[model samples]
Structure formats: C-alpha cells, structure tokens
Target: MRVEGLKLTPVSSAGIEQNASEVASGSKNFGEFLTEALGEVNQLQNDSAKASFDLAAGKLQDVSQVTIAAEKANIAIQLTMQVRNKMIDAYQEVMRMQV
Candidate 1:
C-alpha cells in the first residue's frame, strides 16, 4: 500500500530532539498531539485488518506478523478509548466547577 507523493523516512535524532523541545516548551497542544497519535493508531488498525485477511487467504506467510498487527490494533483501540473516557471525565468536571 503505497501512499502517493508521501515521503516516508525514519525519525532522525535531531528531529526527535526538536519535537521533544517543542513539547517541553508547551508549543504543541495536547489535542493536536492526541489527534496525530490517534490517526497513527487508525492506520495501524487498517494495516492489521489487511494483514489478517491476507494471512487467512494464505497470501501472507508469517503468522507472527498477523498476530503482532492484531495486538497492536487492539492496544491502540484500548488506549484511544481510555483517552476518550478521560476527556469526558474532564469535561464533566469543568461543567461542575464552581464558577
């Protein structure tokens, strides 16, 4: 599955350092960060579904890949749900705040 016109590259040490600095300086909001993180998780789930289908059809050879992909998708979904719950709790707390 090739993404057209997308340049994929490993995160260099300097890039990681820059991102860390921005986060530490509060330059990136939590909502933006979580949105990007959840997008990655959604991509993982799609990939996992494809891999599992291929494995079931005997097109994929490695069972471990299927298993790992499924597990990653599961964990990502669980984490996203937890984050959503926390956000709902926070909203309720704010609504009940004595202003």
Candidate 2:
C-alpha cells in the first residue's frame, strides 16, 4: 500500500513566548489569570441564563443557540470545579509535608 505525507501548517511560537514572559514578569500572575478565567465562566453562565429567558419569552427562535450556550456554561463550571478540587488537594498535600 502506498502512503502519502500529510500536510500540516507550522505552529507559531512568538505568541507562546510572549505569554510566558508576561507571566514570568509578574504583570499577570496566577491570581489575575484565575480571576479572569472565573469571570469568563461567570459571563458564560449569565449568557446562558439570558438565552434561556429570551427563548422562554419568545424573543429567541433558535433553540440550538440556547442549548449551546447552556452546554458551554456547564462545561466551564465543571472545569472550574475540577481545578478547585485539585488546588485543595495540593494545598492539603503541602500542609502534610514536613518542614
């Protein structure tokens, strides 16, 4: 059987390096990043709620859009919960470590 090479586009490293530098310089630390992420998740939940309200009030005709928004919010909440659980576990582990 003959095989052909699959073509792939080159990935950019400049943006990645810039983000790393920003994090390393403390201008945008972990707390700020976490806050921004949580804010985004909250926004998604608000959007989902609005979409649901609009659909119920007959302002929105697209049910799929409401479903998509709700699913996005649900996924974000699940991810945030997992991250919180992991952080708690890590904190506990550190507390248990001998100084």
lDDT value, residue 75 of candidate 1: 94
Worst 10 residues of 2 by lDDT: 22-31
Question: How far does residue 91 in candidate 1 sit from its true spot (Å)?
Answer: 1.0
Residue lDDT tens for model 1, 1-99: 877897899767998899889989998898898889989999999999999999989999999999999999999999999989999999999999998
- Candidate 1 — which residues are off by over 4 angstroms? 1-16, 24-27
Model 2 lDDT tens row, 1-99: 999999999999999999889878879878989999999999999999999999999999999999999999999999999999999999999999998
Per-prediction TM-score, please?
0.74, 0.84
What C-alpha root-mean-square deviation, in Å, does candidate 2 show against the real structure?
2.3
Q: Rate residue 46 of model 2 by lDDT.
A: 100
Ten contiguous residues with the weakest lDDT in model 1: 3-12
Model 2 clash tally?
A: 0
